[model samples]
Target: SLKGEARAGVQFVKAQMGAVSPATLLGLGVGAEGDMAERHAHHHHHHEDEDHDHDHDHDDFETFQVDLPALQDADLFLERVKQVIIDHDILRLKGFAQVGSKPMRLVIQAVGPRVDSYFDRPLADLEKGKTKLVVIGQAGLDERAIKAALQS
Candidate 1:
């Protein structure tokens, strides 16, 4: 059920990427819940008025790496990636995509149970495209499901 929600959310994000606006600046920061708040405060440098304690719990993370096939559709692969991010307690993801004339670099960060929109940038400067990707999360990441999705 959670995976379904994540898939839906990612689909919305994908559509927004094209409909919203051209890619400009993209940044991703990750840590515990406490770390997230601290980082945000640090960047703003003016959240000193509110006294919040940074005693949040840290989550465990696992990692997965797979090379996509030559014919793998970038859009389809991304769809599956959303499933994995949702099904598993995935906290972070970084990868690349080369879809026809559209080339992009992706950085994904998930906080708690939330899968944030990945920042995408045009890779016009690169002479070649890369397909390999690494997914970081907890133990629930299913290698078989991911492989099956990519192969499908």
Candidate 2:
């Protein structure tokens, strides 16, 4: 069922991409017994015995948004964020921040500890000088500690 769902999602994306198959677009093609297929099968089988309750389906991961004060120092702010990512095993992080006195908004993107940032555009009237980020990681993240570290 997982594989079927994955195929359906891929097909939908393929249709959105002007009928181009995802594998062709990405230059990837795998046979039925391919390594990727094997891995997917193994993963599916490994979780076959787990409960499939819809209410608790998202127990594997957690997502939360953090809004904090404007960051004064870019370097310090990035360091703190990196520490949080490492400590929490964050899978992905993305958001915008207002660096002190900077006329533009800082766009932050991170994937598994590799953080990147740049000034995207001039801050809007209402969004100026604000730090807002969405953090995603496996379940059991220390929300209080993460908030405290980023706020400081």
Candidate 3:
């Protein structure tokens, strides 16, 4: 059921990308529940109140390079994604991600509080106009707003 919900959410995001070729679905694990809280809190700009390990988390992060040769609105896309992440408090996600020019969708997942797996996948593997992501997070989130943010 968790995967189902996640899949549905990812599909919704894919629709926002418009009609593109070669998309992959990835499932990323953010980490334990405690880590999720720490990450979300940090994102809120409450670094002073919380103590998180930044030295090691950076090493653990994986980069996902995407190719948007034809996609002219990259800044807008990044802004929308940032807004969605901030609004939803989503920390970990795992679903199908269609890569660029690749018909196969890889199921990627990750877990951790200090690290973000957003840039871990390769653009060559993502499907153009199809950037779909299904994220799971702790309470204090707005799923509807997140979905809307992704679309807008």
Candidate 4:
């Protein structure tokens, strides 16, 4: 039986696996003053689910089709993704990776513009053929720039 942190991890996996998602556990670190856990654990904080929730609440989200080069290879894809996360104030980033004979790897990362958090977990396939990434942040994160960054 799972207990303590193990139990929580299992529980989280169960809930996430049930959804059509792909991501293997990457990193999980909640800030000291941050209540990322509380917000996710309770439904009362539904607002937290949003990527952007601040005073500058002017539409702030960009989703681009994962370029062919990025999708064909995992390493290349990850490199571009990390670049985006590091270069931009990405509040949230999540995507599915499907590899033959391997469990789907879902990568969820949050760097800067808010708190730093990351989670990668293996689950069922969600993206059938194409790949996509949804990013939300403040400024310097436009679709064109993101697409260019991703293609490279």
Candidate 5:
């Protein structure tokens, strides 16, 4: 289902880019790359099962809170997150983005680090797309800078 979703989403984006797709593209998986197609498919299915098994664990948000006092601006906060993404190649990011005048919080979840930044999906919330992210870093993040970034 993840692959299907990814494929459909890719089609949507491609369409936006003025490209059209035949029905055959629907059967192709989007997240899988070249080389280890068989092995990756097998592992990817198993990982999906594991994810379903642990879906409940993800609902708990104990680890989302950040206690750092140094992060004082929203822009700086986003910059730091950008830096983290640049530095770490394996880390996955999922959170919200807020732009000026946008009432909805843009829920953003990026898979992979920096070079492979892929936005996963958007949550259907009523609020102006004001998404929030719980960034994980070795050093504490600046909350104020992050908030300011949203305002700016």
Candidate 6:
């Protein structure tokens, strides 16, 4: 039967990937969306006493957002962003910015020290001229310093 074959395939995969959590596999969306979240939460609570040792500590990750008025100079804005990335040791940064007199929104993305940006679609009728960004890094990020540096 097809159902039996599918079950066999899943069992084989699980056997090959020993110690893989059901939550991790369900995160791939193999199950219904609503049930996936419930299963994930249950698995999280259940695994607190397990012996798994993660390579990196989840408590060491931190994230923050930066929101400001539309920027006038793209060059100056990018320079400041680069400096912030270097100083803060950012792992990933991404967001959209409204640059001066431009019809389209500027999309910014950075991974490590590499930064990239491009103009996306034109601003909608209700969209305001604003810059919004989300920054992710290891714990101990100076949120105040980062916001001040970017705003200036």
Q: Rank the candidates by lDDT, best first.
A: 2, 6, 1, 4, 3, 5
lDDT of 5 at 67: 27
Candidate lDDT values, in order: 0.53, 0.78, 0.46, 0.50, 0.43, 0.78
Cα displacement (angstroms), candidate 3, residue 110, comes to 9.9
Question: Which candidate ranks first by TM-score, i.e. highest?
Answer: 2
For candidate 4, give the lDDT of residue 30.
35
- TM-score attained by model 3: 0.32
Per-residue CA lDDT of model 4 for 45-81, tens digit only, reads 4565676444332333444444332146665566666
Candidate 5 lDDT, 1-152, residue by residue in tens: 54564422233333556665665457465645555644432223455564445334334322233222222344555555555554432144566554454343444455433322222344345434444555543333444554444334
Candidate 6 lDDT over residue span 59-122, tens digit each: 6789999998888998889888988888877788999888997879889998866789998899
Off by over 4 Å in 1: 1-59, 70-73, 101-129
**lDDT (0-100) at residue 152 of candidate 6?**
82
Q: What is the lDDT of candidate 5?
A: 0.43
Off by over 4 Å in 3: 1-72, 93-128
TM-score quality measure for candidate 2: 0.65
lDDT of 3 by residue, 35-127 (tens): 755554324544465575444433433332222232234445545555555545556644444434544444444332222323344445335
TM-score of each: 0.42, 0.65, 0.32, 0.42, 0.30, 0.63
Candidate 6 overall lDDT versus native: 0.78
Residue-level lDDT tens digits of model 2 in 38-151:
343223444555654333435678999999878899888898888888877788899998999888999999887778999989998877878999999879998888888788
lDDT of 2: 0.78
RMSD of each: 11.1, 11.0, 18.6, 13.7, 12.5, 12.2
Higher-ranked by TM-score: 3 or 4: 4
Clashing pairs in 6: none
- For residues 1-152, what per-residue lDDT tens digits would candidate 1 score against the true structure? 54575533343333453664344223233235546544543334333546765432232346777666332355455666666656654666665555555455544344434444443776545523545567776555777776666456
Clashes of each: 1, 0, 44, 12, 28, 0
